[model samples]
Target: MPSHERFRTRREKMLGQLRELFLAEGFASFSIGDLAERFRCSRSTLYAVAPSKEQIVVATVRSYFKTGAERIEARVAASADPAQQLAIYLESVASELQPASATFFADLADFGPANEVYQENTQYAARRVQDLVTQGVKVGVLRPVHASFVGAAVAEVMGSIQRGAIQEATGLDSAQAYRHLADLVMTSLADPKKPAHERRAT
Candidate 1:
C-alpha cells in the first residue's frame, strides 16, 4: 500500500503563510525553519521554493516591489495631469518606504555585492520607473530628458525625502520635503501645457 499525504495544497498554503509572516514581521531575521513551523512543514519543504535564506529574502523584496509597482500604476491611471500623476507617484513611493523593516534595509545595504536575484529585482524596479518616464516622454507628456537620468534623479530625491520623513513628521522638513522634491522633479518632467514658472507655482 502507498503512504497517504497529510497536506494537500501545501505549497499554496505555505506561500500564503509566508506572505502573512512577511507583512507582520517585515522580513526581519526570517528563516525557512520559522516558515516551516508556521506552516507545520519540514525544513526540506522550504527548499522547494527557495534554495537559501538569501533567496527567500530576495523573493520577499521582489514581492514588495511588485505590489508597490501595481499600486503606482493604479494611482497613475487614476490621475489626469501628467505632472500631478508623476508627483503622486513619487510621493506615494516616499510614503511606502516607511513601513519597510530595518532588516530589509540591511539586506538592501548589501545589494551592491554580487547577488543576481537581488540585483535583478532592484533593476526591475528601476526599469519600471524608467519605462514610465519613457512612455510619458514618447507621448509628449514629459520632458525629453534621458529616462535613465530622470529615473535616477527620482530615486535619489525620493530616498532623501523618505529619510527626512523617518526623522519626524513635523516641521516643514517632514510635511513638505517629499512634496517639494516631487514638485521639483515633476515640474522638470511635465509637458508643455503651461509655462515653467506656472508649473512651478503648482
Candidate 2:
C-alpha cells in the first residue's frame, strides 16, 4: 500500500501550495523569498514553476476567473430559460467574486491582464455570454441587439453588480444585489415570442 499512494507530480504540489497560500491570505505582494518561506522550499523551487511574482499573481487571478466561469456555466445549464440562464450566470459570477476585496481591484483598476491564462479564461466567459445572447436574440427573448454588444454588456453588468447592489442596500448585504442582478438580466434577455429550438440553435 505504501507504493500504491496516489500520484502527484512536483509541479502539482507546488501549484497546490500556491493555492493554499492564496486562500489563507488572499493576494499579497510577495517575493520569491516570501513564497519560499510559506512553502518551506528553496527560492529556486518556487521560481522553478513561477519565475516572477507577476506570474504567480496572474496565475492566481486566472484561477479565480476560471473557477468563476465554471460556476456560471453550471448555473446556466441548470436554468430552463435563456433569460434565466443569463441571469443566473451573471449573479453566480458576482456571488463567487464578491468575497475578493476591492483593494486588489483598485490596485489593478486599469491594468488589463496580459497573461494568456487569464485571457483564455476571459474568452471562455465571453463565449458563454455569446451563447446566451444569441439564444435570446434567436428566440425573440431579447431585442435585436448585436450578440457581441449584448455579451459585452452582460459582462460589464456582472462586474459592476456588486458595487451597484451594495450601494442600494441599507442592511441587506450583497445577496440582495446578486438577486437584483439576476432579475434584471432575465428581464433583458427573455424573449417570450421565440421557441426553444430556434433559441437553442442560436
Candidate lDDT values, in order: 0.59, 0.59
Residue 73 lDDT in candidate 1: 73
User: Residue 116 in model 1: shift from native, Å?
Assistant: 5.7
Flag regions of model 2 displaced more than 4 Å: 1-10, 16-28, 110-127, 140-148, 155-181, 191-202
Looking at candidate 2, the ten consecutive residues that score lowest on lDDT are 1-10
The TM-score values for the models, in the order shown, are 0.57, 0.61
lDDT string for model 2 (11-76, tens) is 456766765565445555667788888778887666655667777666666656666677767767
Q: Name every residue pair that clashes in candidate 1.
A: none
lDDT of 1 by residue, 1-202 (tens): 2222334355445555665566456454656667777777788777655677666656655556566668867877786655556666666755555555544444454554313444454355456567777876776767788998877875654454334443345544433554565666776777677676534322
Please name the candidate that would achieve the greatest TM-score relative to the true structure: 2
